[model samples]
Target: MTHTAALALASGLGFGLSLIIAIGAQNAFLLRQGLLREHVLPVVAVCSVSDVILIAAGVGGLGSLLDAAPWLVDVMRIGGAVFLLVYAALAARRALRPSAMAAEEARSGTSLWPVVTTAMALTWLNPHVYLDTLVLLGSVAATHGDDRWWFGAGAMTGSIVWFTALGYGARLLRPVFARPVAWRVLDALIAVVMVAIAATLLHGL
Candidate 1:
């Protein structure tokens, strides 16, 4: 393969690996709703749409500016770490809370608009998201000479496919999550994932 093609492939893989496996607030929320059997399609729809917008923004040279302004990236890193930590704490609290109350809160009608808004915020507000998709992924793509667009395309494709599978796939596990204990376990797992990611981010600083 040519240099540009190689870069495109590597960049696409890196972007996919970074994002595809990480279970974030979006995934947790989707899983929760899937378990409850509520608004699954709409929830996934909003999430996938938000991700496409953010991923496109990242690949379109927005992430490149951060390289010149290292401090800005640092600020984002810190801010994202703090946000993740706060989310982790909240998840932990929910895990410890009584199941009946938690179920009620989860079942309560949450406006689809708010969920979309929240998904957008989660995908876009974090500096790390831009850094990962725009800066890091874009930088790699730039190395590929002219075919960099393909790299971005592949990466974006990965994001769309992954989220769609995750949001919808959660439904397949409905039978398993029927137990109250299963919900607690899922909440605890989400908290752990968030805290672990936050710790990794902080350690880099």
Candidate 2:
């Protein structure tokens, strides 16, 4: 590979990982799923594949298309905020109810379909996904000139690696999460993060 291509790939990997490593709605949900060991593979697949598609679209100039239609962002903002708020309420309820604080009890009742749906919603519904993957990453990829595809490839690789690591690696924490109090604390924190993100989205609109 040419130096430019290598540089672009490295840059893309760094930027992509940086954006994803933060504690956001999607990451929080993924972490929770990972901790519960419920539908981890499918959830990780959805998030990684969604990132691949979005990064490809951005590299193909879909960011430009989105820029032309500001209303699309507005719609996403509203939808994402509503979804986040609902999730926040659910988390808060779980946190407050001592009976629901056990991870095993919670896992027994959750179906695969709801988890899959929530994974998709958390990934695609958020407007920040578009801004980060489409606009920010796309703009950076453009700097690579003809090697933009390589940059995107790097970003996609980062996404896959990060999601895989996060989902599977969370099992290592299972012992810590075995306690009811740990689950309660986790749910409470998730609630705070979700509500904060929802508020940010609503304020943006």
Candidate 3:
């Protein structure tokens, strides 16, 4: 690889990871799913694949299409806010009823379909994903000229690696989350984060 391409790749990896590592609605949901050991593979697959598609679209200059239609973002923002509010309500309910937070009880109740659907919603419904992957990453990738694809490949690598680590590594926290109180605290925090993101989305709209 040319030095310039290598630099672009490295820059993409760093920038992508930095954006994704933030604690947001998607990450919070993924962390919860990881802790529950529920549909982890599916959840990770959906998120990673979604990121790749979005990144590809961005790198391919689909951001221009979005730019031409500003109303699309507004629609997504409103829809995302509603979805987040509903999720926050569910989390708050779980936090209030500690009995529901029991590890074993939480594990067997949810079907794979719902978990997968929720993962997809948490991912695709969020307007910020487009802003980050499409607008921000796309704009940066543009700086690489012909090496933009390589930059995208690097960014895609970051997403896959991060999600795999987050989903699998969450098992290490199993011992800690074994306590019902831990689940309660985690759900409460998730609730707060979800609500805050929803509020931010609404405010933006």
For residues 1-205, could you state the per-residue lDDT of candidate 3 as single tens digits?
A: 9998898888888888998999998888888888878888999999999999999998998888778999999999999999999989888888998765555355645578888888899999999999998998999999899999989988999999999899888889999987878888888999999999999989997
Q: Estimate the TM-score of every prediction.
A: 0.78, 0.95, 0.95
Scanning candidate 1 in windows of ten residues, the lowest lDDT window is 100-109
TM-score of 2: 0.95
Best by lDDT: 2
What does the lDDT come to for candidate 3?
0.89
State the lDDT of candidate 2 residue by residue for 5-77, as single tens digits.
9998988888889889999999999998898788899999999999999999988888997789999999999
Off by over 4 Å in 2: 101-110
RMSD of each: 3.5, 1.6, 1.7
Worst 10 residues of 2 by lDDT: 100-109
Better of 1 and 2 by lDDT: 2
* lDDT of every predicted structure (CA atoms): 0.69, 0.90, 0.89
Q: Show model 1 residue runs off by greater than 4 Å.
A: 1-18, 99-108
Task: Name the regions of candidate 3 deviating beyond 4 angstroms.
Answer: 102-110
